[model samples]
Target chain A: MMTKEQILQWLEQFADAIAQNKEYLTQLDAAIGDADHGINMDRGFQKVASQLPKLAEQDISSVLKTVSITLISSVGGASGPLYGTFFLRASTAVAGKQELSNEDLASLLQAGLDGVLQRGKAQLGDKTMIDALSPAVTAFTQAIGQGKTTSEAIQQATAAAEQGMQATIPMLAKKGRASYLGDRSIDHQDPGATSVYLMLKSLSEVLGMTSD
Target chain B: MKKLINQPEDFVRESLIGMAKAHSDLLKVQFEPTFVYRADAPVQGKVALISGGGSGHEPLHAGFVGRGMLDAACPGEVFTSPTPDQMLAAAKQVDGGAGILYIVKNYSGDVMNFEMATELARAEDLRVLSILIDDDVAVKDSLYTQGRRGVGTTVLAEKICGAAAEKGYDLADIADLCRRVNLNGRSMGVALTSCTVPAIMKPTFELDADEIEMGIGIHGEPGRERMTIKSADEITEMLAMSIFEDIVYTRTVREWDESKGGFVDVQLTNPEWEKGDRLLAFVNGMGGTPLAELYIVYRQLADLCAQQGWQIVRNLIGSYITSLDMQGCSITLLRLDDEMIRLWDAPVKTASWRWGS
Candidate 1:
């Protein structure tokens, strides 16, 4: 079981990771986008991080709902609503739960992915956050179905997410600002997918340490 | 990196403060959820017109909010779309019991946020309609892509639609008029230099002195191609010809469906210009370029129109819409029918653009 403390740690770690990789992600976006992905994500996540202390008294569902509201209001781009919806749907899936079982975690991941897919309307291979997030959710559900622990399942999900993120490198972008580049969009790693990978990796790290 | 800013975070707010102060008689600025609304907003029974997008494009959504223009304008951070809360607040502030119309640009963030705002407004039992402006001929329309980016034509649509609203056009009729304006317009721009967002503190892209990015959008997003810079006449010809020769571009757009109480996709096709068509030619400076340069561009554009037997009945030459300090310009050619011509000639009073009463 993953406790509420682990969820808080995962968020804190993910915020730190975003701060560290901010410039790198911005650089990646400079190649094909407006070059503010890192700046925008960091702005939103830092706000989420600052609110963690206040969320301590809240249940898991409420905590995640607060994060979603903050992200949606603070992050002012396509990623804002996309990530906000993910958290909002995840919160709904885990309503009233203070901790998550493996099955609950799987449901959470699936709900979040479904929200992103519905919000962005991006299918697989469209070169978006869905590229990483869809595979990660699938891998997590599969591992959980085979009797894997939450940490092991998240580990498998992170690995799948990494591979999916890399696969975006050569895609001709069919969505977002990069789509304007046409053939020029090829060969640049998608910034949204890269950020999604970081999110899953941070969750895996927090869960892995707790399991140990 | 050199910019006239106190702090990167306060750049947008400070500029907005200055604008609100300067135009106190025209509009009022609301903080926190940051939106600018007309001073005498909630005009009795008038359909409220609201529009928004990222900052840096001055005299756009915000500067154009006044009599005979937008009722409210929500500005996000520099190059970022405003959140749904801002739009919802603006709608509530300006809705006059008739309805609300949101003039949204076709950027991804702007689209999603405005869509959410429409839903929120509807949930509160406030009638709202949204019309998308996507007239940039630069991005090729396709099923896979998000279609074209809305550019210069957005300004024209706002002016025309605002005039229609002032003339007591109903919510649905004004929505159709906005859609009509978008269908009749096409634009293409060439960027001579990359613009630096204040937060980023560097140029969005780097270009050598002799190179120019053709078909660029207003946000400094990379355009169709980068090539060696040419003379003023050649560049104007390139931008103008692309718009003039563009085919009947078709794309799907979402608008509020009153019967379903939600958005529904509608395919729209831009009309092809024939000889002897009346045109409203706009030569817009992309922030850094001067009026003299834009006039020179307009000269070339006017000559091209005359050569092709298209009559340039109306023209607006200056920087009305802009990217931040990007040394470039865009050419927009809008075919005008009788009603559009009358609306274009209608009285408008705003901070950046005003004429007649």
Candidate 2:
């Protein structure tokens, strides 16, 4: 069973990854965007870390919402709302659960995607964060259906997210500000997809999931 | 890049101080570590209007805060949206019981932050309504596309809407008016060069000297298409015609309709026209472009407008709004009727914008 404490720790780890990789992500954005993707995401995650202690006693859903709201409010750019809505929807979906079952994880992932679709209205193949998230969710759901352990399924999902993130490098952007670049948006790695990879990698570790 | 800023992080802060120093005659500065509001906004009977976004889009959502435009503007870090708490404090300082109107640009961060501000303001029993401006022609079916971004049209819309509010239009009216202006306006932009974001210390995008990007947003985001430089008239034709398609103009007119505020769907379909439509056109500079080039571009745009039978009631050609040192320009056309013309002529003043003396 995954506890609320673990999830919060996972968020911190994800934040740390962003801080460590800030220069890399901003380098990617420098080719196509405003070049603050890493900085903004790092600031938001740091803010989340500061608030995590105050949210320790709260329910997992509430804690997640706090994270969502803080990120959405602090981070500027499309990433803020996209990530914010992801956590908000995920927390709302997993509300009232003290411990999440293997199946509960799938529902949480689904909630996050739904929120992204609602806020970003970005469809699959739009070369957005959805590209990585949808495939990862599918990988997890399929593995769960195969009767694998939750840890194994999440491990599969994390791998899938990493692959999806890498896949964004060659795809042409069809959503957000990058869409305006048309063909030029191609060949550049998506910063959002990169962050999703970081988030999922953190999740795989905290859940102690080593195999699919 | 030879700006007088102390550090990259301190540009917005120092600019706020400069605005206070430069315009002490028109407004007071509130640098409570976040946003700046009008020194006299509270006394202005009409509802307080507020708008903000990432900082690099200079003279926007901030410089336009004064008499007839936004009462206050919250400036975030470079290319970052202000936090909700900052907005909440601004709302309290500017709200005078009449209400508050948030003229939010349709960027994702701006929308979310403004929404949070609305909720926080409501928690304090302040009446707040937000009207999102999505005048960029780049995004389509805005409800379906990644959503329309508020672009050059914001300056024009805010000033006109500001006049209406100053004339005692209520919150609901202000909200609808904001929507109306956004609906009627359409804009397309181009970039001749990329800009360097100070914090990141790199060019936002790479562009060849001869390449010009179409559909460029105010932030240094790449444009819809990159092409070799062409004649000014040819470029103006492309932009003006693109804007013409998005404007849903109609010939249907109501005789002396008092309730509808005298609005008509003025079409710009025919290219071979003597009178296109009454238009408020803007030849907006993209930061590094000079006033002389802007005026020259305006010259071509004016001829194009006339060739299309479009009557130009108002034309603002300058860098009232801009990206940070990006060499480029945009065109905005607001199809107008009698009321719009009257509002266009309304006297207004703000730090970065002014009309009718």
Candidate 3:
């Protein structure tokens, strides 16, 4: 079971990763988007980071909900509502869970993917955050179904997410500002997909380190 | 990157503070969830007109908040859509017991946030209706992209609709007039350079000295095509022809149905423009472009419309809606009926646009 402390660590790790790669992500977006993906995500997560302290003693669901609210209010782009709904739905799935079991984690990720799908109306291969997140959730669910530990499941999910992000390099975007590029959108990695990969990677790192 | 701002993060807020102070006689600033409301808001027995978007397009939302324009304007971060809380609060503060009409642009972020605000405001039992202004003909369709963005036409819609509300038109009539304004308007723009978002402190796109991005949107999104820089008349012809050649565009948008107490989708179609139609020609500068250049564009646009047998009955040439420091201009051709011309000529006293008082 993943403890509340681990959840908190995951959020911090995600925030730190976003802060570190902020320029790189913005550069990726500059190629095809409005060139503010990194800036927007960083702004949102920074607000979530500040609110994390007050949410430390709360239930895992409550903690995630707080992050969702902070991100929604602060992010202010396609990413804002998409990621906010992600966490909000995940929070609902894990409602009342102080610690998450493998199945609970799988459910949380799946719920997030579903929420993003509903919010963005993006399907697989749409060259959006869904490209990474959809695969990550499926991998986590499959890993957990195979009796894998939370750490192992998250590791598998992160690997799939990385692959999914890279696969967006050849996609013609069908949604968001990037879609304005049409064929020109091809050959560039989607910044949203890259950020989603970072999210899973951060979560995997937290769970894997705790397992060690 | 070389801007006159004290801090990068405080860019939007600081500008808003300056605007509030500068326009104190006409408007007042509200904090927490920042919004600029009319100095004498909650105008009893009038349908309130509320409009907002990302802040950099100065004189658009905030500057237009005054006597006969928007009742309130919510300014988001540089090129970022404002959150629903700001709109909800603005709606609560400005709702004059008649209703509130939200004029939203066609950007996905703006559409989604306004949708949420409409839902929340309705939940609070405040009457509300929303109409989207998507008149940019740069993008072709909604099938593959976010569709045509709302650009020059949005400013015109606000001005016309705000006047309609001032004339004591009910919420439904105001919403219909706003939608009609959007339907009859079409705009296209070009960019000589890209603008930098202050927080990022870098240009969104790089353009070579000789190259121009044609059909550019307000947010510096790449246009339909890029080409070598041409004469003002040639560029004006390019923008004008695109609008003239555009087919009848149709799309479905959402609106709040007070009687049904839920949202309903309304199919809207912008009709084809016929020859000899009287039009309101607007030549707008994209921030960095000078007035001399805008007049050059307007001169070309006026000539082209006349060549095509269209009459320029009324014209507004200036920097009404702008991309921050992007050196370019957009031409908007809005077909005007008798009612529209009457509303367009009505008195408006705003910080940016004031006449007929």
Candidate 4:
């Protein structure tokens, strides 16, 4: 069971992952976006850092909700709203629960994607964060249905997210300013998808059953 | 990559200070808490007109701050919406006892934050009216993000509505005029090159040299289409045709008194060039396009207007507003009448703006 403490740790880790990969993300964004992907994601998670102490004692849902609001308000640009919506939906998915069950985790992940879609209005082929998130969510569902443990399902989801992120390199963007490039939008990596992959990567590394 | 700045973070503040220094006779920079206000603002008995958004969209919201445009404009970080705290401060400081009117673009954060500021001001018993400008005929309306965006047309809305306010129109009348301008104007943009935000340190998006993205948002959000780069005439035709279609299909200029007239017989006045009744033309730059290029576009548009049998009355040919360093321009026309022409000619002083002053 992932305790609320573990959840906090994961949030902190999420922030850390963004900080560590900030430059890489920005480099990718230089191609498809305004090159603020890493900067915004880093700034948003950093703000999420200050709230950690206050969030530590709260319910997991409450803590995540705070992160969502902070991100939406401070992160700015398109990424702020996208990541903000993700956490808000994640919080809703885990509502009234102290810790997530295996099924609960999958539902929460799916719910987060739903929030992303609701906010960004991006879809699978749009070459946005949805590309990474949708694939990850599908993988999680499939793995869990195959009787994989919670840890195993997360690993599968993480791999799928990474693959989905990779797949964005060749697809043309149909949403956002990047879409303005039309066919030229292809070949460059989607920054939102890259960040989503990082998010799933953290999940898999932190909670997956490595032994399995 | 070498920009005229000491530090990227301090760009907006330092630039505002320079603007205030250079145009102190017309513009005043509020220190400590930041914003750009007209030196003649808080006009005793008049309603305050406020508009602001992100910083990279320069000369907009700020360049329009003057006698006939904005009373005050709050600047936020690059391409980011200003906070409610900033908006509230502007709302309070610019209140002239009559009331305050907010001209907000139809972006998500801007709308939410401006709405919050309006609510907060209401708590203080200040009468505030707001008109959301959603004039871009690009993005489809959705339950999440607002439909279309406030784009080049914001300049026309601000100028026209600011004129109404200058005429001592009441808050309600000014609000109605603003809404009317919003209804009348439509804009579409094409980007030849992507612009880079200083903080972001890279182009907002990628656009190949050989192609152009049509229907792009000022935020550098992905556009709807990418087509082969076309000639100035072809591009002008596409953009102007889109705007005309929006005006016609939206029925923005339908005859109010069908019994009195067929189509609205409008007359353009305050002619920038002595000519017959054509229309008001604005050949605006998308930040990086040169004035010479813009004039070339103006020539094409003037030809277009001549071809349409529309007399070119008043024409503004320059970058009145910009979208960072994107290399392109937009064509905007306000089909005006006698009153609008008088209002357009009204003297106004502001940062990077002076008309009949």
Candidate 5:
């Protein structure tokens, strides 16, 4: 089971990761995009990080909802609505819960992925965040269905997310600003996918440490 | 990297503060969820027109918020799309009771955020409709890409549709007129130098002194191709030729459907330009280029039109829309019909554009 403290730690960890890799993400975006993905994501997550202290007493759902609102209001790009909707749906999937079971975590991941798919209208190979998010959700859900622990399932999810992020390097972009580049967009890893991979990896680390 | 900015984070707000101070008589700026609305807003029984996008394109959405134009304009960070909250707040501030029409440029962030704002506005029981302006011919394929990026034609559409709204056009009628304007307009741009977003503090891209980037958008993003720099005449020919030779471009667009209570896809095809068509020739500077250079481009553009048997009935030659000091220009050719001509020639009083009382 993933406790409420672990959920908070996961967000804090993800925000730190975004901060640490901010320039790296921007460099990746510079290759195919407008080169502000890192800056924009950092701006939103930094706000999210600042709000986490106040959210310490809230239920998981309320905390996630607050994060969603903060991101939607602060991020101000395609990432704003896309990531905001992800957290919004994830919050809905685990409404009123103080913690998450293996199945509940899988549902949260699946719901978040579904929200992104609907919000962004991107498919599996669109060279967007969906590329990393969809595969990670699938792997996590399958592992949970097979009766894996939350930590084990998230580890598999992180592995899948890494592979998915790598796979975006060779794909042609068909969404967002990168889509404007056409053939020139090839060979550049998608910055959105890279961030989503970091999110899953952060969750995995948090759950693994808690389990240990 | 050099810009007159106090802090990267305060760039948008400080600029907006200055704009509000300078144009206090024409428009009012609101903070928190930032938007600029006409000083005397909510003109009863008039369909309100609102438009917004990234903030770097000055005198665009914000500078145009005044009589006979947009009721409000939401400005996002340098090149980022404004949040939905900004749009929703703008709608609420200037609804005018006749309904609201959002003039959204066709960029992914702008599109999604305005879409969400539309839904939110509807939930609040305020009538809202959105029309997209996607006239940039730079993006060649609609099927494979996000369709064409909205560029110069957006300013034209705002002027025309803003007049229509002033003339008491209903929400649906104004929406249709906006769509019609978009269908008749086509644009292409070339960039001579890169621009730096204040937050980024570096040129978005690089080009040697002898090279120019073609088909660039307003946000400093690289365009279709880069090639060795050519003369003013040659560059004008290239840009004008690309727009002139563009075929009947078709794309599926989303607009709010009140009856369906959701968005419905509508397939729109731009009308083909024919010989002897009357055109509104716009030679626009990409911020850094001077007005004198734009006239040079206009000279060639007018000659090219004359050679093709098209008449340049009206022309707007200047940098009304720009990419924040990017050196270059874009050319927009809009075929004008009688109604559109009337709307285009109508009186407009905005901070950036003002003619006739």
Candidate 6:
């Protein structure tokens, strides 16, 4: 079971990952996007970081909901609504649960992915966060179904997410600003997909520490 | 970035504060989710027009907020679309009991945010309608890309739709008028240099001195292709022909259905332009380009229109909508009917644009 501290750790670690790679993500975006994905995500998560103190004692759902609201208000790009909706749906899925079981974690990830798909209208291979997130959720659920621990399931999910992010390379974008590039978008990894990978990686890192 | 900014993060907020001070007689500022509205807003029994987008596009959406223009304008972070809260608050502040209409651009963020705002406004029992302006022909395919980006013609739509609202048109009538304006408009732009987003403190894109990005979007996104620089007349012919020789564009967009109380998808097509069509010619600089350069562009644009047998019945030539410090220009040709022509000529008293008052 994932404790509330683990959930907060996931958010804090995710924010740091975004902060560290902000310029790199923006550079990836500069190839085929508006060159602001990292900046926008960093701005959103930084606000989330600042609000963590007030959310520490709250339930996991409350913390997730607070992060969603912060992102929805601060992040102004396509990433904003997409990520905000993800957390919002995830919060609903795990409502009132102070600690999340392996199955509960799978449900949370799957619900977040569903929210992203609905908000972005992007399917697999659309060169969006769905590219990474869809496979991550699938892997997480599959591992959990096989009776893997939460830490093992998250590790599997992060691996899938990394592969999904790399798979974005050579795919022509079909949505968002990168879609404008058409043929020119080939050979560049999607910024949104990269951020998704970072999120899953952060979650796995947090789980590895707590469960071990 | 050598800008007159106090801090990178404070750019949009400080600018709004300055705008409130500068245009105090015309508009007032609201905080939190920032928006600008006419000082004497909620004009009784008037269909209020609300529009907004990123902050760097000066004199657009916000500067155009005054009598006979937008009743309220929401400004987001530089080059980022505003949130639903901002739009929702703006609508509530300006709804004068005659309903409200939202003029949204076609970018994904703007479309999604405005859509959410429309739903929220409907939930509040506020009468609201929204129409999108996707006039830039920079992107080629609607099914493949995010369709066309809204560019120069948004300013024209705001002016015309704002005027229509001032003439006591109801929400539906004004919404239809705005849609018509979008359908009849086409624009194409070229960027000579990239602009810097204040927070990022770097140019969004890089262009070699000898090359130019053609078919540019308003937010400094790269265009369809890049080519070596050409003469004024040559570049003018290229940008103008992109619009003039463009075929019919068909795409699906969302519009607010008041009866259904939700958004419904509607297919829209750009009306093809033909010879002898009376056009409102707009030559807009992309911020860093000087007025002299814009005039040169306009001169060539006029010659080309005359050659193509199109009549320039009215014209607006300047940098009204811009990318921050980007050196470029866009040309918009909007087909005008009698009603549109009359509305375009109507009096508008805004902080940035004023005439016939």
Q: For model 6, report DockQ.
A: 0.65
Better of 3 and 4 by TM-score: 3
- Over the true interface, candidate 3 deviates by an RMSD, in Å, of 1.2
Segments of candidate 5 deviating more than 4 angstroms:
none
Cα misplacement distance, residue B82 of candidate 5 (Å)? 0.3
Evaluated against the true structure, the overall lDDT of model 4 is 0.75
Model 1 agreement with the true structure over B1-357: per-residue lDDT tens digits: 699999899999999999999999999999979999999998989999999998989989899999899999999888888999899999999999899999999988889889888988999998999999999988877576878888999999999999999999999999999999999999999999999988888899989989999999988788879999999999999998888779889988788899998888898898778999999999999999988999888888899999999999999998888999899999988999999988888999988889997
Question: TM-scores for all candidates?
Answer: 0.98, 0.86, 0.97, 0.76, 0.98, 0.98
* Model 6, position B145: C-alpha lDDT score: 81
- For model 3, the stretches where C-alpha displacement exceeds 4 angstroms are none
What is the C-alpha lDDT profile of model 6 across A1-212, one tens digit per residue? 79899999999999999999999998888787877889889999999999998888899999999999889888887888889899999999999897888888889998999998877877798788999999999999999899888889899999999999999998998888888778878899999999999999999999998653
**Clashes in model 5: which pairs?**
none
Interface RMSD of each: 0.9, 2.6, 1.2, 5.0, 1.0, 1.2
Clashes of each: 0, 6, 0, 8, 0, 0
Worst 10 residues of 5 chain B by lDDT: B138-147
Stretches of candidate 2 exceeding 4 Å from the true structure: A51-62, A92-99, A145-147, A167-172, A209-212, B1-3, B21-33, B119-125, B138-144, B231-234, B244-276, B355-357
Candidate 4 - chain A - TM? 0.95
Q: Candidate 5 chain A: worst 10 consecutive residues by lDDT?
A: A27-36
lDDT score for residue B232 of model 2: 74
Which segments of candidate 4 are over 4 A away from where they belong? A27-33, A50-62, A89-127, A134-149, A160-175, A179-189, A209-212, B20-48, B81-149, B166-176, B188-194, B200-278, B337-339
Candidate 6's residue-wise lDDT over B288-310, tens digit each?
99999999999999999999999
Q: Interface RMSD value for candidate 6, one decimal? A: 1.2
Off by over 4 Å in 1: none
Docking category of candidate 5: medium
Minimum summed lDDT over a 10-residue window in model 1 chain B is located at: B138-147
Classified by CAPRI criteria, candidate 4 counts as incorrect
Write one digit per residue (lDDT tens) for candidate 1, span A1-212.
Answer: 88999899999999999999999888888888888789889999999999999989999999999999888888887888899899999999999998899889999989999998877778898888889999999999999889888889999999999999999988988888888898898998999999999999999999988753
Error of 2 at B247 (Å): 7.1
